[model samples]
Target: MDYTIEIATTDFITTESAVKGGADRIELCSAISEGGLTPSMGHIRKCREMFDLPIFPIIRPRSGDFLYTDEEFDLMMSDVKLCKELGCNGVVIGFLLNDGMIDKVRIETVVRAAYPMEVTFHRAFDRCKDPFIALEELIEAGCQRILTSGQQIKATDGLDLIKQLIEAAGDRIIIMPGSGLNPANIKYVAEATGAREFHGALRSSAESKMEFMLPSFAAIGDYINPAIKENDVREFKKALML
Candidate 1:
């Protein structure tokens, strides 16, 4: 079976590590703690220069719900255009109506603006009222893939539903299982869901390099740095072989 592992990267450091560890592609984003927001133009350009793998930058304007305001939608469009200008392979995006359905009109607009660049609907599909209905909408909107956890917190927890989605999707659109995937469960999720593409972040906690400790003030809340470990990435790829 032909399969590819996409690493959800937060910065250039992680990007370089993932590439070295054999990541086929990267979903470039910022604030991965908030479920991934759009990365800066500089980051995109730098990654493009640094890696030979495909880079699909997320187009989310902020770190909140999928229901975006008009201004936010405009900002997302600008980011899409910028991705195209920077020669990105694709753009990851999603939008939903207040009624908990796919925003077909707006999504179509964004897809049209994306043009030759591929579009992968993000986990915002999990928030929709109906997965099957939303799947059809995304396929109609010209999306190449849908990254979802099958309406659950983690892909392993939603294995059954993900299997159904993959069967339903067939050859029309790629149903990629993501969210909370790791080396421990990647093999199971891939075998169960029968999905060819998987998305995950092989992250680990790294202690800050500060010898002097600040007792009172904290710069980044608890000072715990969550970074992608090259060993973890290699393990994840190994799991795919199993």
Candidate 2:
């Protein structure tokens, strides 16, 4: 069976590593540590220029809650349009009502805006009051896929729900398992959840190469950076096949 590996990359370097390491697709975003924010237009354009694989940029304006004000939702809409204009394969987005239901109306608006490009509702599905309810709602909203960890912190811990969701979805929508997935656990996640598409950062730390460091200014740069290892991404894809 063929499985798809979508590597979540935060910057140019890690994106390059993921491509070199053989990611099937790219979930391009910024501030992944902040749970992923919409990447800058320049970043989007550059990635589109450099990579041949599918690129789906996240359309999040901020990090805190999934609830968005009208203004914030408008911002998200603009970002979605921009991604389309830049020739993205798709865009990942999510919004929730205060009552903890899928914001289907707003989500539908985004789906329309995205047009020919596909939409994958991001992990905000995990925060909804109900997963099954939200799953049906997302399908009704016209999303092609939902990237979730089965409402858990990690796919490994959420296998039961993930499996149940897969059964519930049953080809209606792609339930792509994500969050805390890596090369080490890829095989188990695939086996346990029966998920065809997986997502992860697959990153390891790399130290910055600056020879001179000022005592007080040393805090400016993260001397140790989180980066994708080409081999780890390769192994992650390999594990899915096993």
Candidate with maximal lDDT: 2
| lDDT tens per residue, model 1, 46-123 | 999989999999999888799989999888999999999999999999999999999999889988999898999999
* Candidate 2 segments exceeding 4 Å error: 217-221
- Could you estimate the TM-score for every candidate? 0.95, 0.97
- In TM-score terms, which candidate is top? 2
Residue 219 displacement in candidate 1 (angstroms): 10
- Candidate 1 clashes between residue pairs 3 or more apart in a chain or in different chains: none
lDDT of 2 by residue, 1-242 (tens): 98999999999899999999999999998999899999999999999999999999999999999999999998889999999999999999999999999998999999999989999999999999999999999998899999988888887888999999999999899999998998789889888888999998876878778897675766775577779999999899988777
Tell me the number of clashing residue pairs for each predicted model. 0, 0
